[model samples]
Target: MTERTAKAARRARVLDDIDLRLLRALWMDGRARVRVLARDLALADSAVSVRLRRLREQGVLAGVHAEVDPAVLGLTTQALVMIRLSPNTDSRAYEERLRTMRSVLGAVALVGDFDLEVHLACRDMADLERSVTALRDAGAESTHTQLIARTVAGLGQALLTEEEPA
Candidate 1:
């Protein structure tokens, strides 16, 4: 094997306990300032910065994004749609198509009975119906939908550990 390839492999395995601690800190709070993180992790600021830069370069740190509350923005209607596709269908193609629609917030490729699970945000029941109808017209054999009453947890909060820090 090439020496460059072997060196890259070694570098990948060099992450230690400190790196894991830094990652956990970032995961809990993406907006954490580098200085504060360095203090918390009891490492030098430059060291923390180096680790963060390396993590970003290695693609371990994808991108930091903000989390917004949909309910506060008057998006009161949230629906989970279970779509069943035709036999031997290419659901991914349809999934990509659904993503292009404004109401579709997220889509997941599923196994078993349902081919895709879609999450949608709409203004009301009528809008939800319209969105579902469009999906049906686009080749979904059938869909089962349930209105979300509340969102108890979200992606940002869900990433943290269940137990609070002492």
Candidate 2:
């Protein structure tokens, strides 16, 4: 789908107060039982279950996953690497190449100066260097990288609890 169509599809999901509460509770602890969430939200267990199912169906609530610490996995360094591709290059091909790299956690296509931004988790500086080299080999014309000093907040904190004006 086109970017505008994709945005419109995502915007179509309407989240109400109960959905917000359910998301908040899940963010705090993904594995929380429906009974506990219902108790916390003062709703019936069956109602909470149905709401959760609806959220999943609407793609508002993705799968619950374990949040693993990178340090424990020997990936102690994090970096944001912005890449500018050669003119007329197929960005989808470059993104698919990035997906094959184990160090790349995620990639985002950008609208401005940078063509893409990559989030990387590496064992050390050498690993990061290798990752950059791989990107260069994959057709990145230029790159700007910055080591992440710290994360102030994460995806959980950024989730919307209420709808904003369109």
lDDT of 1 by residue, 25-129 (tens): 887788999999999999999999999999888766678878776667777799999999866557767877886898888888888899888998988899999
Instruction: Assess each prediction's global lDDT (C-alpha) against the native.
Output: 0.82, 0.86
Please give, for residues 33-87, the per-residue lDDT of candidate 2 as tens digits: 9999999999999999999998888767779988777878999999999999988
Quote the positional error of residue 158 for candidate 1 in Å: 8.5
Model 2 lDDT, residue 166, Cα: 52
Top-lDDT candidate index: 2
Alpha-carbon TM-score of each model against the true structure: 0.76, 0.85
Tell me each candidate's RMSD, in Å, in order: 5.9, 2.9
Candidate 2 segments whose C-alpha is farther than 4 A from its true place? 1-13, 154-158, 163-166
